[model samples]
Target: MNNDTVIVTGSKLTIDEVAQVAINGAKVGIAPEAQQKLTESREFVYELVNSNVPVYGFNTGVGANKDRKVEADYYNQFNVNMVRSHCVAVGPEASQAEVRAMIVIRLNTLLLGYTGMSPAIAYMYRDLLNHNITPVVPERGSIGEADIACLSHIALTMIGEGDAYYHGEKMPAKEALAKAGLEPIMLGPKDGLALVSSNALAAGQGALVLYELKKLIQLADMVYSFSLEAFKGNVSPLNEEINRVRRFRGQNESAAHVRKLLQDSYLWIPHIANALQDPLCFRCACHIHGAVRDSLHYLEELMDIQMNSSDDNPCVLINQNAIMSCGNFEVVNWTVAFEMLGIALSHLSRAACFRTIKLSSEHFTGLPRFLTPDPEHIIAFGTIQKPFTALDAEIRHLANPVSMDFYAVAGDIEDHCSNTPYVVQKTRKIVDNLYYILGIEAIHAAQACDLRQEKEFKLGIAGRVVHQKIREVIPFLAEDRNLTVDIANAYQLLKSGVLLHALNS
Candidate 1:
C-alpha cells in the first residue's frame, strides 16, 4: 500500500486516513499483517463453532437471545436473518460520503481481526469503497447503540438485498455490484453482526467532522488576528511575557501566533498602543481560542485511539482462542467529546460574530458606521449584522450537549447510550454556521482595512494574506451592493483552504 491507499493493520489507520477515504475518495487496502491476523482469528472462530465453546453471535444468538444456541446448519441463515431483521431505519438516506465513511471505518476496525471475521469480508468493504457502491443507509432509527440499523443496510447490500447508489443512480445492489465488476458476499456465522454492531457510523461521521473542524479552527485563528488588526487593538496582551508566566501550551502557541500575525502591523510601533486595554474578546484572544484548541487536541487523541480500537461486541481474542462478550460499542466518550467540541465552536463563532459587530460600531473600531466608505449618504454594511444574528442562534443551539439525553434500551441491557451520530452531525451544522459568520467577519475586517487605509500601519503577513484574498472576491463596501454573493464567495475561499494555507505559510 502507498500513501494514496489507507492500509489497515489494526494499529496503522489514523483518523486522518479515515477522513481521506471518506471525503477525498482515497483508496483502501488491507495490510498483509491484517490478512494473516484475520485468517488466524477466523480459524479460532471456526473451531469454537465446531466445538461446544458457546461463542456469542457465532454458535450462539446475540442480544436477548444470548443463551439460545445456533444450529450449525443455519449459520448463513442466522447471519442474513439478523441483518434483515435489524434493518429498520426510516427517513431520508444518508449522503454518499457518509455511507462511504461508515464502510471505510468498519473495514478498518474489522481488519484488526479481533472481531473474528474473515479477510474476504474486509476485502468486500474495500471493494465497495473502491467501486463507490454506497449503500442507501437511512438517517434515523439509531439510538447510538452502535450503528445497528444503519450498518445493517450496508450488510443487506453486501448480500445483494437492498438499494444502492451506483455510479450516480439508485439501483438494486445486485445490479450495482455487477456494474462495479464485483459480486455479492455470503454472510458467515456472525458476519452481519460484526458488520453493523459497532460505532462505525458515528465514528465515521465524527471523523469527517473532525477533519473539517481542524481547518475551521485554523481559519478562526487567522480571522481573529485579522479582526484584532482591523481594530488596531493593543498587541501588549499577546506579548511573549504574558504567557511565559502562565505556561499553558495552547495559550503560548496562540500568543505566539498572534505575535507573528501582528509583527508587521503598526500596533507594534514600540510605545504606540490603541486603547491601553481592548475588549475581552480581543484582549483574552489566546485564552479563549487556546482553550478550544486544547479541546480539539484532546479530541484528536481520542479519535486516534477510537479509529484503531476493536469497538464491536463478542470480541475474539485470537491468542487466547476465546470469544468474550464486551460492551466496547458504548460510544459515550465520543459523544461527550463532540459535545465539548460544539460548545467550544459556538464560543469561537460568537467571538467572530461579536468582533464583527464591534467592528461595525463607531466606538469600537472608530471607522465609519457599518464600515461604510461614505457614512454620509450610504448604509453600506449595516444590514450585514442581520444574517450573523441568525447564524449565532444556530451555533448556540447546536452547542447544547446530547450525550446526557439517552437512557436504557434493548430490555435494559443497553441502559446507557451516546447520541453519537447526532452530536457529530450537529457539530457539522455548527461548522456550516461558522462558514457564514467567519466569512461575514472577514468581509468586515477587510472593509475596516480599507476605511483605515493605513499605508505606514501595514497588516502583518498573516493578516495581509487574508485581507488581500478577501479583496479578490469582494471589493470594499465602496457604495452599497447586495452582499449575499460576496458573502458566499468569501466563504468559498475559506472552504477551499486558501486562507488557512496563506496564514500558516
Candidate 2:
C-alpha cells in the first residue's frame, strides 16, 4: 500500500487499480511509454511555440482571451499566473482517492500526446503520486469550464504554491515537498494549461460512482431476495418461459440471478395458493430489477469510455494539419448517462422501500405490525427515536431527482447542465441510505423466517443463509425496545459486504 508501488504501467491497470490510486496507501507512477509520449508532446508544443505559431493556449489566449497575444518573454509568468489565478474552488476538500484519480486520469490524457505537457511536468505528477504527496483539491466549483478552478489547486501544489496532504497531514506545499525530499519545478509554457484544461475531476467522480454502483446493484439484488422471502411472496413472475417471451438480455440475466438465489427457498413454491399469480413486478423481482441491471450495464460502458478519454479542449494535433478545438469539453454524454443512472437508482430505492413497507404491513405478510417482533416495544419518537424511524424518511428522500433541477450562471454562458456532481453525490448518499433500509428489511425477513421455523416450517438453504446473516448482527427481536441499534447493526452488515456475500451464496 505504499505510495511508491501503485504505479500504472498502462498494461493491465483495471478499474480497481485506478480507484486504488486514490486511496491513501496507493502508489502510482507512469510507464516508460507514457513518459516518452509526454516528452514528444512537450517537444512538439515547444517547437510550435518557438516558431511563433498561433496555438490556442501557448502563444494565444484562452476562451474569450483567444484573441489576446502574449509576449514571448512573459510566457513563463503567464504559466505560473494560470495556476495562481484559477485556484478558486471552494467547498469540502476531496478525498485523497479522488485527488489521486485526478492526477492519474489527467496523466492518462496527457499520455495521449494531445495535452502538450513537458516531460518534467509529467514526471513531477508521477513523483507526487509515488511519494504520497497529493494536492488538497476542493469538491466544488467549476461548471466544467476548463476545470480551471479545480485543476488549478492541483497545479498550484505541483509548483509549491498551494497546499497538499503528506503523511496523512495537511501542510504547505513547500513543506510537504521538503518532507518527501522533493523540490517543486517551474511550469513550462504549456504545463499550466495542460494541467488545468481537463475534465479529470468529473471523470474521476464518474469512475468512483461506477465502482460503487456496481456493488450497489449486487447488494440491491440480495436485499430484494431477503425481502421477497420475508413476505412469502408469489414467484410466478420469474417463470423462465415468461421471461423468454420478452427476449430482453438483461431481463434474462436478472431472471437467472434471482432464480439461482431463490432455488433453495422451499417457501416460495406455490402449494395450493389462493392466488394463481403474484404481483409481476416486485414479486417476480427479476423483471423490474433486470431493467436496472440493463441500465447499469449501459452506464458502465459509457463511464469506461469517459474515464479513458481525453475530454480537454484545443487538442494538440502535431501530426494533423490543424488543431482541433472541439466540444469534447461539453460533457453532455456524461450528463445524460449519469441522469439516466439517477433515474434507475431512484427506481431501485422505490422498489426496496415498497418492499420494506410491505414486510412491516399486517395486511400483506400477516406478520407482526412493523415487523417489530413485539409491538408493545414501539417507543416514543423525538430527536433520538428508533433507527427504522429515521431510515424510513431517508430512503424516501433518496428518490429525489437531482438531475432534473437546473441553474443558469455567468449570464447564461452556462445556462443548463446535468448537475452531474449533484447526481453522483446523491447516488452515493442513496446507496448509503439503501444499505440501512435493506438492513431493516434483513431483520424483518429473518424475524419472519423465525416465525415460520417455530411453526416447524423452514426456508430453503438460501433463506437460511440470509436469516443466519441477519441474526448474526441482530438477534431474534424478542422485544424491540430500541429498534435503532438493530437497524444500525443491519446496515453495517450491508456496508461490510457480509450481507451481500450471504445473499449471493
Candidate 3:
C-alpha cells in the first residue's frame, strides 16, 4: 500500500483529515491483507459461539449484565438487541460532520479485528462514507463508555433499522439504504459489543476540539498583538533571547509569534523609549499565554494518539487464539490533559479580559477612556455606547472553568468521568469569547492609531495582515453606531482565518 494515501483503518485518521476525505472526495479502502485477519477473527468467534467456549461478549452479558449468559443460538440476536435498547440518546441530532466522524471512529475500532465482525461490517461503513449516508446520532448522553447511546444510534442506522440522513434528506435507515443502493448488515457474534463499547465518540469529539483549539490559539495570539499595540506597552520582554532563557519551547514559540506580529510596528517601536517598561498584562503575556500554548500542543499529541488508537476492551488475539484484558479504554490520558488545558484556557481568557479593561482605563493607559479618539466621548465609552466593551464582557464570562469542579454520579460506575464535555464546551465558548475580545482590542488599537494621527502605524508581516483585515471590517470607528455590528464583524474576520493567514504568510 502506498503510504501517501490516507487509509482510514479506524485508529489512524485525524478528525480534520477525515473531514477532508469526506468533503474533498478522498478514496476509502481496507488495508491490504487486513481482510485475512478479519476472516481469522470471525472464524474463531463463530467457533466459540457454537462450541460452548464461553466468551465475555460473544455469548455472555455485558457490564452489569455479564452474569446472565445467553444460549449460543440466541447470541447473534442478543448482540443486535443490545444495540437497539441502548439507542437512548436524546437532544438535537449531531450534525452530519459529527456523525461522519462517529462512523469513522466506529469503523476504525472494528478494523482492529478484535470485535469479531465480518469484513462486511467495515465495508458497510465504507459504503456509508462512499455514498454519504450519515446516521443522525444525538450529541448528549454517554459518560465516555465509548458513547454507548451515540454508538447505538449509529448501529441502528447501519442495520437499516433506524434513522439516517440520505442525500441531505432525513429518512428511515432502511429507506435511506435503499435510496443509496445499499443493504443493511447483520451483526456477527461480538459485532454489537465491538460497535458500541468504547471511547470512540469521546476521542472523535476531543480530536475535533483539539483541532479547533489549535486555530483558537492562533487567534488568541493575534488578538493579544492588537491589545499590545493599543496599550503601546514595551516589547522588550518579547525579545527571543528572553524566552530562550526560560528554556520552554512553547514560550519561545509564542514570544516569537508575537514578535513576528509586532516587529515593524510604529506604535510598538516609536514609543518604546518613552514607555516605562510594559505592563504585566502586555510584558508578561508570553509567560501566561505561552503556558496555554504549550498545553494545547501537548494536548494535541495526546489526543492524536487517542483518536488513532483502539481503546476497546477484551480485544481478540488471533495468534494467541484468545481474548485478553487491556485497559486501553481507560481515558486518564485525555482527562488529565484536558483538565490542565481547561485551567490554562480559562486563565488566558481572564488575561485577555483584564487586558481589555486596562486598555480602557485612564489609570493604566493614558489613552482616552476605552481608547476612543476623543476624550470628550469618555462618558460614551463608560456606557459602552457605539463601542463593544459590553459585548466583550459577555465573551469573557465564557472563560470561567467549570471542569475544575468534579461531581460523582452513575451509581459511582462513572464517579470519575472526564467531565471533558464541560472542558470542550467551555473551551469552545471561550474561543467565541476570545474572538469578540480580540475584535474589541482591534477596535481599541485602531482608535489608538488614529488618535496618534493615523500615521499608518507600522506592523510586522502577520500583524499587518491582521490589522488590514480589521481595518476592512471596521473603518476607524470615527463616529460609532452599534458595538454589536463591530463585534460581529471582528468575529467573522477571526473565524475566517484572516489573522491566521497573516501569521502563516
Q: Which candidate achieves the best TM-score against the true structure?
A: 1
lDDT value, residue 230 of candidate 2: 66
lDDT of each: 0.83, 0.69, 0.70
- For candidate 2, give the lDDT of residue 33: 81
Expressed as tens digits, the lDDT of each residue in 7-36 for candidate 1 is 777776776788778777788878888888
Pairs with steric clashes in candidate 1 = none
Clash statistics: count for each candidate: 0, 5, 5
lDDT by residue for model 3 over 1-505, one digit each (tens)? 1123357664676767755544444546777556666777788877767887767777787766766788867866998899998888877676676666666666666776776777788888878877778788887776554577777888898788888888678989999999988888877677788777777666656666666677887777777887776666777788777789898877888888888777677655545522677667777778888888888878878877776666766778777877765666777667667767766766676676667777768777666776666666534244443234444455445445444454665444445555454455555555666676666666666666556534555655655676678888887765656676776887788877767876676
Kindly report which residue stretches of model 2 are placed more than 4 angstroms away from their true locations once superposed.
2-13, 268-275, 279-281, 375-418, 454-456, 460-462, 501-505
Error of 1 at 299 (Å): 1.1
Candidate 3: where are CA atoms >4 Å away? 1-5, 22-27, 267-274, 377-416, 454-456, 502-505
TM-score of every model versus the real structure: 0.95, 0.89, 0.89
Query: Residue 53 in model 2: shift from native, Å?
Result: 1.6
Give residue 386's lDDT in candidate 2 (0 to 100).
44
lDDT of 2 by residue, 1-505 (tens): 5534555543344556677776535666677787777677777777888888788878887656777887788888888987788888887887888888778777666666777777777777778887888898887776654467788898888889778989678999989999989888877676777788777777777677677667767767666666676677766667789889998877788777776777767545556222455444366567666777787778777766666666666787778844567667666666667666666666666666666666666677676666655567642122222454465466456545555566776455456555555555666666677677667766767776665533425465556677777777778756535767877887787788675576554
Q: List the residue pairs that clash in candidate 3.
A: 10-108, 11-308, 146-198, 146-199, 265-458
Best candidate, lDDT:
1
